[model samples]
Target: MSDEVKVSDAEALRFHAEGRPGKLAIAPTKPLDTARDLSLAYSPGVAAPCLEIFRDPNLVFDYTSRGNLVAIVSNGTAVLGLGNLGALGAKPVMEGK
Candidate 1:
């Protein structure tokens, strides 16, 4: 196998710095065009699902993004090439990934 990197370190840095800093962002799946939409997305309408999830924890997957999203958590203790760099050092590396 080849251990070649397609992008240079400087190029990668520029790509991230030129944009909105990080690669991830949050966006609403539904439209919030009116007070009713706001209430449903935030207050009274939200309570129904909250109550359901409270009764059955597994329901969180069905009602929320938890089912579709996977959180990548690490302390950088085993970073590639650089081992045991700790959480603070691992943050930038993890975010870049």
Candidate 2:
């Protein structure tokens, strides 16, 4: 792994501000555009998998996003600015990630 240093507050802030919201996005890897796709994704066809999941709850991991998502939480009590704390204080750090 390479060592990358955070140079200046302004540079850091610029990157954060440019992406104001966050650093990652989630999108479906498969396409669902036709009637068959609709059926397979949401209706009768979907129910087949849903029933399988219902029979074995652990199957949710194989069919849904729950298996791959991550939640990063913090209280922000010790951020760079003593004046900032809580969710608002941690927003920049979270977005930078």
Candidate 3:
């Protein structure tokens, strides 16, 4: 890659500061355009599955995104051979992953 194509420190900082600070966002998997959809996605219609999951804990994977989602957690004490860098310093690295 050429030097001009590489991201500079100022560009990296500006990219994060432009709109939302973080790189992650949540989006609904089901339609939520109507009141019925809202009810199904949120309240009364959601209760059936909630009750099922309550009855069987394993149903949580079927009813929720838990099966597909992954969470990466770290204290930032050790990162990619950089040594103990701490949490704030690790934010960019974690987001990249």
Span of ten consecutive residues with least summed lDDT in model 1? 88-97
Give all candidates' CA lDDT scores: 0.85, 0.75, 0.88
Per-residue alpha-carbon lDDT of candidate 2 for residues 3-50, written as tens digits (9 for 90 to 100): 987589897667656854456667776688788987888888888878
Per residue, candidate 3 scores C-alpha lDDT tens digits across 4-81 of 677898998998778888787788889999999999988999899999999999999999998887878988999989
Off by over 4 Å in 2: 1-4, 19-21, 78-84, 95-97
* Candidate 3 accuracy as lDDT: 0.88
Q: In angstroms, how far off is 72's CA in candidate 1?
A: 2.0
- The TM-scores, one per candidate, come to 0.72, 0.65, 0.66
TM-score of model 3 vs. true structure? 0.66
Ranking by TM-score: 1, 3, 2
Clashes, model 2:
0
Q: Residue 54 of candidate 3: its Cα lDDT?
A: 97
